[model samples]
Target: MRTLIPTLLFFVLASHCHGQVERDKALHFLGGNLFGLAGAGIAKQASDGNRIWTFVGSVAGSTLIGLAKETVDAGQRENGWDNDDLAATVLGGVTIGVTIDLFSKKDDKRRLRGRYSKLDLKKKKQFLQPTSEFVVLEGKLPSLNTLGLSNQQFVVE
Candidate 1:
């Protein structure tokens, strides 16, 4: 629900730039989205799920790619650089980055809540306790006697 507004706003701004529609801007926008997604994935893996790095990586990647494309276009004789194209690319990046950051933050909050909710000793003990399932055949498993179950009552299979 929170993401819908920003997404709609991005499209509205992108479509209505300078009161004219530019078909070339769509390619730039799609390119930015692709690069931004790649950057977000790389950042998430490198930063161990850090939201800041993920957001930064996404925006930076898109902006940098857009800048590079504009620079190249400026050097050409027939094809010139367009700010609107670059803006569209950057907007795409911002949209993706914001969405990723929002989702990641929600996940972080959920994890935090889960951690705090497991503060009870009984709950912790139950969570940490091993169940009566064993697959190892060569090594000795932890004693079940300490858990109030006799060794004879335990089955190897």
Candidate 2:
């Protein structure tokens, strides 16, 4: 019974330590996400929506920060190195980039719709009207603008 008690105590202690380590890893991952998101936001504001600059700043900043953390942990000799943390940082940055791209696409669609809404029927027709130059279609080629069907539903073989 005495030996059993000691074994149980040891197991409980080990589980507690394991839980603490997992919690610490979670915190680090979340911290990386926040840092990467901030970097992305700052880059977007600074570069005025330039995708290349935003991506570079966000991913590089987060990755560098993660590497720095690993370096510090290495010096401490306790946590050693964690590749998962670095991967999480990169994933966070990519998430931000994808989010920004989605927003940009949404804005583009809105602007296009608004522009089209402002145009009258005559203007809409005029916009799709092709030039007077006629070209002969000898081959079975699909041409959307050839039959005044630009932006309209048409079948293509």
Q: Compute the lDDT of residue 60 as modeled in candidate 2.
A: 67
TM-score of 2: 0.48
RMSD in angstroms, all models? Answer: 13.1, 21.9
Candidate 1 lDDT (Cα, 0 to 1): 0.74
Candidate 2 ranges with C-alpha deviation above 4 Å:
1-21, 104-157
lDDT measured at residue 21 in model 2 versus the true structure, 0 to 100: 57
Candidate 1 regions exceeding 4 Å error are 1-20, 104-157
lDDT of 2 at 122: 32
For candidate 2, give the lDDT: 0.64
The deviation in Å at residue 50 for candidate 2 is 0.9
Q: TM-scores of the models, in the given order?
A: 0.55, 0.48
